[model samples]
Target chain A: MTIFTNFFYSFMASLFFALLFNAPKRSLPVTAAIAGIGYVVFILITQNLGSKPLGFFLATLIMGLLCEIAARVLKMTTTTFVTIAVIPLVPGLGIYRTMQFIVQNNYEAAVQIGIPTLLAAGTIALAIAISTFAVKLFLHFWQQ
Target chain B: MLNEQEINKIIKIVKLEAQIILENGGETYRVEDTVMRICRSFGLIDVEPVVIPTGMFITISHDNLATHTIIKRVRRRTVNLSKIDAANLISRQLTTGRISLDEAIIQLEQIIGDKSKPKILTATASALSAGFFTLLFNGSLFDFFIAALCGAVIQLFSFLLQGEDMSNFIISLTGGIFTAVIAITATQIFNMGNMDLIISGAIMPLLPGLAMTNAIRDTIQGDLVSGVARGTEAIIVAIAIAVGVGVVLKTLILMGGGLN
Candidate 1:
């Protein structure tokens, strides 16, 4: 129930952003649904794998793949759609934590949280990029 | 033989064709010259064209003449407006709601207009910036309703103050700083969640981080020129955002003032 609720909220938030960006009217509802499902799946996997560094990397990779597939199916711009949909998965909390540490003058803890936050964001982007390239390659071959 | 520019002209001409047909109340023959004029304007000088015949048949009756006359007027109006210049003029007049559709169509036929691209890209960028800020501060629900209303007002302000050539880096920086101040104030006044989270999350849309990542990826993939340009732009935007926010925050702290 908790997971379901979280997914619902995330979907609503993402969908709201998608519409605000003037995303295609037809795709907004589907994008929001998939994003919610993606969040739930991510939470489940992360919990099972524990908070290990490797687990984090793998989870982000899978999330990126899922987002790419959704993007292709929707036939829309990947950057705009994927970026907005993946908001729920972003470590926004981590960024906040880092800022808090900085305000308290805890330079060490701030660095610790900030570095991981940056890495997480990069990993998400990397996964999306790789998946996007793969999708393009597949389309080329299919066309030929 | 149609060049790229001519092909674009034809597309614009075809879009106008629909409006002409509709205004003629479904008469096909009277609007034929408009189509030919459009083709000529596009420099399709030596062309063999086929006309697909269409007509409206009516029984011989007293009421039919009035209908036929109305249809004739519509068809004549269609032919007159079919030229590219007439079409362009009519399109603009219609868009601005300055003239009736019938009059615009008549004006369209007499002119072969040149195509002019608009210089609104800079205005588009500024509007996007303001939209991003509104999204961050208001969230999805409220932002959607409010941003659109605010966007038009802000657009005029941006146009007058900065013009279309205003730098994206400067715009993003100012937006980010404004967003941070608002977020911090809201958090304090509402006793919201950690100020850090609210502030950071709110400004995520304005971050140059995503742009940097994309730029690096493109560079690594051998798109050197695009990568370098995007990377440089991202770095500049990021520096501007950080400096703008940092200065404001530092000022507040130095003055022994807090958001609360």
Candidate 2:
């Protein structure tokens, strides 16, 4: 029940973003599906490992690869789906809360919160970098 | 058709396509690479292209002792993946000799001329995404509906104000203020839903995901100029959203709004 609800809402979020990004209409369903998978991977990893950043990195990595594969199969640029599907894992809430802490003059608590926020953002970057490199490597080998 | 006039035209075509891609939030390296590849396909060597967050520069140095250069100052950037996709298709076709230069220009013009979805549809998209993101964060159904309302309003407001010369920082700041005002009011009056989840969901779509990814990708590829530009943009955007929400929450707390 929990997982189903998570999947449903994530799909909705992705659909909205896909529309806003002006993605081709035909790829909306695929974007939603990929978003669902991304959230699921994040949940499973975070639940098992209790590390939010690690979960984020792994989820983004999976989503990036899936987006590339989908784009290839669909003959579309990978950007459209990747941006939308990855939306569910971004640490927007964390950043907001960190700011709230600072505004309240709670410096120590802010740092505690801010570290994780930055880490989450960093992990997202790292994941994109890794997946991009992997894709290039895969193509280079495949072509040769 | 491989004359000086045609080469000059091809240079313009490649620059325009690259500019469109960059203007639509494409990665900087991808922009440079795409332009380079297209020029290479035309047998034009020494093609130089430089791209940043706000503008682009490209110069095609050919054997005819004539150089064609373009300077495009992009005033805005949005998350239009469709533009990038269309540009890619054209570049691929041109490189593979499946399309002629003039045909590719026509195709690009068609892509550029394509109209965005109707305002009503985009606003609905904002509403649905915001509401659903709240649900994903474990908000109640009541919260979901209210979030949808807040999201829709934000979207419509932003779209309506798209031509007012408003910067992103200001747009998100206003978005955050409005989102918090609605979320807090609903949570208090109706006595339902989590305020945090609702506000975050409404703000999620406004976050700079494209900028963040492009920054990372460019930094990894050693394109420090593009990387830093996009990174600064992402950071500034994040701070704007955070400050907007923080200011509202602080004000509310001071006004006797309690967490109980």
Candidate 3:
């Protein structure tokens, strides 16, 4: 599929997820748009880094930040929007990769990928946390 | 026409209106102002509004029956006052010194307890089920079938376990593990991917990633208590699936089991 098509799918998927959580109607469009942007960014980073772990790291961080901004702009709970946005970023391939390693009895490779996957998930979480803190701080200072 | 008792009743009605709005995820400031306006409309000019952060509460007072009638009229047409409408109406009586705070609390508890049970359960199940199906399909047809099944099962299980008083965490964990095992087995056995990616996609509704993402987002958003609680619950569910799969695979290896 074309990049545009892919982004559309990503956006719709995220929107559906957001709706599941009963996200405010106003927030859905913004969340979907940001999530699409996150997917595109991930694709570009992956292509450039050529499967390096750092590439995935950067992509997740970017996605997290984008999601946070979308949540703030929509004035909805971050839990609903961010969760939906991150759906596309899930390492489905990583799980498959880990399964292949385990099946092959390559314990070393499995462990390596497993730890990195865990870290990758953590990096995404950290990015969201940092961005939220920054936004809150900015709001506090701006109000004063 | 407005007696003290009626004035208090109107005030209570407004407070309940504010509480319902906030609980449905409105901002704190908005709810406070809404409550204050309702009081003002009821002619409680000297009403000192105390803004409490953690607990959602509103109080209104009216001087007489006419004021209560007016407040009732305003409340009936108000949007998004489902849960706290009754409480707010009662609180107005309290504020006019018609009823004691203890009475107001008892009434609030009874109204909230009775009204909230069905709505909360239904919403929670629907949300979780919808979330599950969306993940299962990765935006494909398989999501629809699997989501429906998972949603039904989760709803039924939740309903049954409501009597047992199990938490959402336990329900989600058990549901996740069951879904994961079924998905893995279906993928290996049926080769459903060849026909529109059905089997693997069906399992998508059970993914733990959605919960993890939500947990992280909540934590980042400063709802640390709920975030940590949800995060831990999600992690545990993930680990349960991993362990369950690991054990099954180990058993199969020992038994010389092969994919049929």
**Whose lDDT is greatest here?**
2
Report the lDDT tens digits of candidate 3 across residue range A13-109. 5665555444556666777777777777777776776764566556666766666666556434454455557666665435434543565577999
Number of colliding residue pairs in model 3 = 28
Name the candidate that leads on TM-score: 2
Interface RMSD of each: 11.5, 1.3, 7.4
Per residue, candidate 2 scores C-alpha lDDT tens digits across A1-144 of: 478877887987898878877787878999899999899989989999998888999999999999888988998877777877888888878877787778778899899989988988888878977887899899999999
Per-model DockQ: 0.11, 0.77, 0.14
Docking class of 1: incorrect
Name the candidate, 1 or 3, with the larger DockQ value. 3
Question: Could you tell me every candidate's TM-score relative to the true structure?
Answer: 0.55, 0.96, 0.57
What tens-digit string does per-residue lDDT give for candidate 3 at B122-240? 44444444434343335344444444454445545555655343334455555544444554454457545221122223223334665565466556655565467557755676555
> Whose TM-score is higher: candidate 2's or candidate 3's?
2
Fnat across every predicted model, in order: 0.12, 0.80, 0.11
On a 0 to 1 DockQ scale, where is model 1? Answer: 0.11
Q: lDDT tens digits, residues B148-245, model 1?
A: 33333333433344423344555556654665565556545755434443444444444554455556556556656546665676667655655655
Deviation from native of the Cα of residue B31 in model 1, angstroms: 37
List runs of model 2 lying over 4 Å from the truth.
none
lDDT of candidate model 2 versus the reference: 0.84
